[model samples]
Target: MSKHNVYKMSVASVYPLLVAKAEKKGRTKSEVDEIIRWLTGYSQEELEAQLKKQTDYENFFAEAPKLNPSRALIKGVICGVRVEDIEEPIMREIRYLDKLIDELAKGKAMDKILRK
Candidate 1:
């Protein structure tokens, strides 16, 4: 008793890529279709909203949280955070920093900088 569904996604440009992944994973086209169907049980608008929230939270905390300009630095604030907690190792390269700054400089978004 297999409970699966066949559905379509309007991923026009990347449709070929999705098919290629399915093939690479040795899954039938219908199997891929079923997985997509299960995922799409969530409304597109809801998924997009969740994605936006995730993106916003990730961007907001990309840098280490700092003490407010006028506020005192408590022992808890400094001691509670680990080096890895504040700095994401994946984004530690100079190339990444330059690219991030350049993207923000385009005026599309503002990524705050953390000064030690």
Candidate 2:
């Protein structure tokens, strides 16, 4: 599938999966929210608004108030692709979020998950 198609995917569709991954590991929804906010700089209200709107990943990211600079430091393999090797900016951002969620699901410390 094309990157465009992936970008156009509804974040709402994936949100539950992320929540489930964390919950199954004894993490909370609020922790998932915190990871997202750390990555995208979205406040609780803004994040909830996006969730309620069922925003596509593209717009959810594009309209971000601020994407944290530390996101660039997130390095991992997601979907069999090394995030640092992704050439497209948008795809990299998407993978960065994926990686953060993966770390959260694995029970990494919140401080480490935030790349602090």
Candidate 3:
């Protein structure tokens, strides 16, 4: 799908897939939640509210209470593209989450995966 189409897709629809990816590799959904919270600065309740609202990705990141500055430390490739090299801000945020989930699935420690 094109970037525009991806931006319009509901985060709720995509959330399960992220969770499933980690779960398939013996990770828990809680780890996925922690990753998201670390990246977006969303409290668990706010994250759940966004999911229930079926917010699209563009708005999900846009409306985040505080997009973590530490996210810039999340340097790596996701989908063959180095996330730190992405120019479009929203796309970078998306890829950051993807990379985190990828790390979780790869059995990377939570402290390192979170860039803590």
Best by TM-score: 3
Q: What's the residue-level lDDT of 54 in candidate 3? A: 98
- Candidate 1 Cα misplacement greater than 4 A, ranges: 1-10, 42-116
- Each model's RMSD to truth, in Å? 20.0, 1.5, 1.8
Clashing pairs in 3: none
For candidate 1, give the lDDT of residue 70.
19
| Top of the candidates by lDDT | 3
Candidate 2 is scored at a TM of 0.94
Models sorted by TM-score, best on top? 3, 2, 1
Candidate 3, lDDT over the whole model: 0.93
TM-score of 1: 0.26
For residue 60, model 1's alpha carbon misses the true position, in angstroms, by 26
* lDDT tens per residue, model 1, 63-82: 22331331111112222443
Residue-wise C-alpha lDDT for candidate 2, range 41-107, written one tens digit per residue: 9999999999899899999999999999988888889999999999888888889988999898898
Q: Per-residue error at 43 for model 3, in Å? A: 0.7
lDDT of 3 at 61: 96
- Which is superior by lDDT, 1 or 3? 3
